[model samples]
Target: MSKTDFPRRENFCEFILIRSVGNDSYLGNIWSDEAKFTKNGLFKRHNSHYWSNTNPHVFRERNFQESWQFNVYCAIRTDRVVALEFYQENSNSKL
Candidate 1:
């Protein structure tokens, strides 16, 4: 590691320690690499007998395609919400 990198790393570790004080609430924060889910009216079983199953494999795949998914970023402090952000479908922010 270079000496120049020490300040940046030190700042990050300091930030984590400060944020973590008395609050495990940091664990609720969503990370970039984690998977996110959104609700979409696709694979859900709305009707019981509306569809017939022919090939189980194809049906299984169609179910997946019909489901909905999305990502959200939010932060909750001790007794108050510090941040709540809903990103666009194309937003790619990471931390």
Candidate 2:
């Protein structure tokens, strides 16, 4: 397969720290419109946040955008960004 085979699909992504229910964790909603995928997995136009493939053409990602941390990402692949996302910052380092 080639990179063109993977269709660009729009989607919304949000991460909630499950341990924050009552553990007093400050991690809150981490949302991003940059949840859209490509042959490169998830990506964001603002920063260099992207997925890393383990092998050639393998869809499984071994590394994530560690620099992304806790932020709402907006994707820009084609020409316009239509996805909407909302998120809050957390005092923790591991979002």
Candidate 3:
């Protein structure tokens, strides 16, 4: 995908890392709408966070054979992710 297809680099602020629970890892990307203003004085105004989760069962169903699996979490706005936390499943606790 082209750079434009993704959120503006200038608008990106930070990434919140979420721990895996039940082999699912959640992640959040944060951004600011004001930073998306173009040089021509036009504001794109699309501020939001992207979240994703990883699931081992889904991966295995897809023919993935990895010993460990993770799910990613996503968010649409900075406020949506007030805090980041990580959790370990019984299988992953040893690691």
Candidate 4:
């Protein structure tokens, strides 16, 4: 594949990883700076939601640190995410 086939580094963003308390289960979600997940945070980035379904206001650092095993992962492109969530979905299904 050519360099053109790869997404530019600037397009890449940080993601969040959430580890469930008292269990081995883990979750990777969108990134949010407000969470301040320095150790737990992933490379995914810039204002995205921290978790899949959990509200940002609720799934915060205080609660997470209290419970522990929280937060991050690898890189993902926001542009691709938008394309899949909006453009691709419109073509794929009505939902």
> Each candidate's lDDT (Cα)?
0.56, 0.43, 0.34, 0.34
Local error of candidate 1 at residue 93 (angstroms): 3.2
Per residue, candidate 4 scores C-alpha lDDT tens digits across 27-65 of 333433212233444323455556665565654443345
Per residue, candidate 2 scores C-alpha lDDT tens digits across 14-72 of 22234445755334333234333444544454565447655455453445554344335
Q: Per-residue lDDT of 1-95 in model 3, one digit per residue for the tens?
A: 35784565434422333232332334333532112222233223243323445643332123335434332223354347543333233223452
Q: Where does the lowest 10-residue lDDT sum fall in candidate 4?
A: 82-91
| Candidate 2 wrong stretches, greater than 4 Å | 1-70, 89-95
lDDT of 2: 0.43
TM-score of each: 0.30, 0.18, 0.20, 0.16
Q: Model 4 misses residue 53 by how many Å?
A: 18
* Residue 25 alpha-carbon offset, candidate 4, angstroms: 50
Candidate 2 C-alpha error for residue 55, in Å: 32
TM-score of 3: 0.20
Error of 3 at 30 (Å): 11
